[model samples]
Target: MMQLFRHLRLGMKIGGGFTLILLLTAGVAVIGVRGLTSIGTTVTLTTETNRMAHEALSARAQEKDALLRGEAQTITQTQQHITAIGQQATTTKEKIADPTINEQLGAVVAAAGDYAKVFQQATEVRQQQTAAEEKMAQAAETLVKMAQAIRESQYQLLAEIQEKTQVAIQANRANVDDVSQIIQGIMQLRLTEEQFRLQRDAQTQAQVDSRHAAVVQLARNLQARLQTARNSVGTQVNDGMEDDAGLDIHTLAEQIIDLLETHHAGFTLYATELTEQLQAETEMAKQARLLEEQAERIRADQQQEFAALQQLQHTRPEVRNATLANVQATEQFIRGVLTVRLQEQRFVQGADAQA
Candidate 1:
């Protein structure tokens, strides 16, 4: 080998050796560059995916907050509307001094109060709904974490699968089980949600079946046992049973139940009447508010027309003729004001006229 190498030119040998070294170095460089590029691409893809997930989560949170805030704002607006209606009703009552309007206004105030209570109740329910949504979201997020863990386990399984070793096979089997378990948990959540969707009647039936049946039987047995005890204790005191002396316990209980039921019925009837009156008042309030809004709009339009007319007169030459449009608008504005004022006068005079 030394003799063969010695036969070659010294410069040729050096150049060939250097060229081989350079080719090997270039090959290594290409492989390193490719490895680095692959790593960088993977990192970028993972970062983009994480960013997308974060953005999606943020969007969901924002949507939830927007809904909650929107409802709260709506409730506040409704409250303000109710308060304004109440104040206007009161003022109208005092100014007109109409017994009917006063009565109607009182009914409106009461109805508004009831409506406010219902509104508060509804708001509380919304809060509960929000809480339920949050809980569901948290559950979904937890499940997502489980999915991520499952994915990691799957990767491990795949890596180990290639080794074809016992440990690898066992790990793959465990990963499969883990995946199944996660799927089962997801299914369980779905089932639980489905259960929650059951109707109230069906839920009541289930409760009766599970608990009430046992309770009923127990009560019957208890009553029978108690009767026996009383019979034994009474027998020792007397040889015979009393026909119906002071066994007024049942009768008294029945009478008490009857009294309560009567009271409840009376109260319910009164409440129903109140609700109807309030509903009528609410309608009246709505009508009054609409009329007032219309009147205000008319006034605003008239004011604008008046301002325009004034501006026109000031800007025009003293000898300039009034436009047909200006003359018509001015007449319409005066008629509108008189029409509104007449309506107010008629309402204010109504009680006295009726009397």
Candidate 2:
């Protein structure tokens, strides 16, 4: 029991010694690790705080520079504005004091106003002048048309008169040829004096009877035609009076009557001679054709030649002259009026331009 107790005490001493050694080593290792961790954390926190401080300083410096530049720019802009205001004031003073410049400006303003008014008046006057010119031109054109119409009407009237005159002349020519042929036939028959007397008496009586009937009929026909011509002439004169704005229709009518009178006697004589000649020609042709048909053909040929001679009389100068004179007179009157109107228009235009 004594040995066991001692052994236990020694074992306890040994175990306590080992436990103390282990506790000492473990406490030293824990303190060393904690010291290292605290040192590393302190160094890292210091570096981060230093970097943040440097950034704050740089930001403050940049803010100061921006504020300085903004102040300088504001000062320069204000100075420039003040200088510009001074220049404007100086220029205003100079303009207000210069008499010649002020006068010139006033003159320019007045001139502009006057020019506007003058331009308006000029435009109005030009329009009026143009309208007047157009009206004058239209009037002149109307005159020209009237003149042309008058000329044509006069020409037609003269041509108709000339045709009538030519017809009278042709009839006279036919009568003369027929009378000559009748005389020639009588002479060529070679009848004895007694036979000639007896044949002449019979022929004269027959011719007298035929001539009386033909003359009565011709007189009746001529009277009717004369009445118709008179009615037509009266109607034409009235129409001419209405149509001719400036012509003397009474004088024209008198001239027409004179022309008719000039051909009247010749026309009557021609008809009488033509009738006698035709009667003699028929007798001669019958007498000659009783023996031969060839003689009848020859007589017919002579009649045709006489008819052709009458047609040629229509080409006389008197007929053409009458037509030309009437047309020229009417044309001259129209042209003269138109020319005068044109001249008046030109004069008015010139006056307008001067005004």
Candidate 3:
């Protein structure tokens, strides 16, 4: 093989060498193109992940704001935000090259979903609580009115009893002082009963019971004193007039108390429900925050990946530049070699590598 190569003519050897260099240059170009292509793909993935992650973060923020408003009217808006976040997560997942980032993004999607469900439930419960509170307020107003009516009825009864007792006093003027004092006590007792009606639950139920008992006792005393006076003086105490008023007042008072108690019980129960909803909302908010934080972490990861890709993108150009320089140098060297070969061929006429 050495003897045959040595016997070749100069022109033939030059042609063979040029052909080999050409093939080598072509191979290098192919390799460079393949490397640049891979770099371009990494850059694309990084850019897509960055864009999707930004969108997801924005959507998550909007969802949080909607939840903060705590208004049922915003539920649809909140749902839309969550949906947008989910879509972003899906898109980002596709674009993310790193398995760790992809998995974390999936967790963000799941947490967002959980938050969405609980947030909707909380809003619905809040609406229910609002409605229940309105009803309770209305009932409370009605109870106040009913209690007022009972007070007025009691006043009317006291007036009638006093008037009946006064007739006996004038007829038996000797006992006028004693009867006058009793009438005065009856008026004072009616005033005290008014206090009971006005009393609130700031005091315990026992206090309320005590006041209620006192009112009953005072009413009874007034009725008894009036009856004794009527029996002694033979004064016609129209039994039906006082009986009907007292009975009506008692019945109405009981109803007012019942309503007030019902309102309180309803308030406690509804408030408890509202409290539970609030706690649930708080928990969901925390999960949403965690999801948001995780999305941010993913975004950060994407940014880091993008930085690395940018560096790789820079290296690709450098590699291309280096390859171009090598090709240019090789071309210049080949041209010099061809010029030398031409001179030699002209000077040593008809000489070739084949001998």
Candidate 4:
């Protein structure tokens, strides 16, 4: 091959040399173009990755702010931002060469979606809590009204009892002492009932029951005396004995007996009313306690959710601290509300104030 090349014309050799040079130059150009294209692609990928990272970081900041502030508008803004970040991540994952990076992007998208759902749930829970608190306040107000009505009724019944006792005393002059004793027994019963309502202890309740029995016995004795007087008066009338004012002693005795029976009936009605009022108060207290327990359970659930959120890998230290503080504050506020409700319930039920 060297002998054949040496025998070639000089012009042909020069043309061959030029052709070889041109081929070498074309090859170098192709390699340089390929290198430039690769560098441009790498730069674009890096820029997109950086932008996505920055967007993700911004979304995280917004999420933390939204959670700390607990505002609907802020949460909505955070959700929008997260959605945008997720879309960007989805697009970036398609471009990413590494499978691990794509997986990380997918994780970020899922985490952002979870955060949004969690925020929505938290908002709903807060709304439910607010409604429950309002209902509790309304229940407390209703209890107060019921207590006031019961107290007013008691006062009215007591007044009526006093008026009836005075009428009995005036009507039965011959049995005035017995009537007075009945009145005194009724007054003692009233006092015992008041003590029971105030103390609400077993001893006070026993005293009230004893006083009621004494009052009933006194009423029975007065009734027996009135019956004896009525029989005696009837016998006198049959014997033609009448009062100086031309009033029939038999009719007077009958009127007195009727008044005594009416007074006893009134007392029985008052006792029934008092029992019903006490039962109503007990039921109200039970309902209030149940509402308080429900509120406490909801608060506990909220605290547990906050703790779970804090434990997430994406949760920042600052956000965790803020969440903890918010939880403590909410607990303290709820405790104060519960204490007030408990006191109100105790007041309505006539339970021990100290307890």
**Clashing residue pairs, backbone N/CA/C < 3 A, model 4:** none
Highest lDDT scorer: 4
Q: lDDT tens string, model 2, 1-355?
A: 2234233322232222222222222222222222323434323322322232222222222221222233444434433332332233233224333343334323323322332232233233334434443443343344234333434544444444454656444533433333333223222221221232234344544453343344334323433443444456685343222233555323333333333333233323433433443343344234222323332332344345344444545675442333233233323323432343354346436645754
Worst 10 residues of 2 by lDDT: 17-26
Model 2 misplaced stretches (Cα beyond 4 Å): 1-100, 163-355
lDDT of 2: 0.33
Residues 217-250, model 3: lDDT tens digits? 4444434554565566453644322346354433
List per-prediction Cα lDDT, in the order shown.
0.38, 0.33, 0.44, 0.46
Which stretches of model 1 miss by more than 4 angstroms? 1-69, 154-158, 161-174, 184-355
- Name model 3 segments beyond 4 Å from true: 1-73, 91-109, 166-247, 277-314, 317-355
- TM-score, candidate number 3: 0.47
> Can you write out model 1's per-residue Cα lDDT over 1-355, one digit (the tens) per residue?
3345334432222222222222222222222222323433323322322232222222222322332354655556545544543454445345433344345445544443443444354345446545544554454455445444444545554564575657445644544454454445444444443343332234533442333233233323333433453455565442111212323222322332343234334323433333433343234334334444443453455446445546566575231222223234334433543453455346436634643
Candidate 3 global lDDT: 0.44
Candidate 2: pairs in clash: none
Q: Estimate each model's TM-score.
A: 0.32, 0.22, 0.47, 0.33
Scored by lDDT, model 4 comes in at 0.46
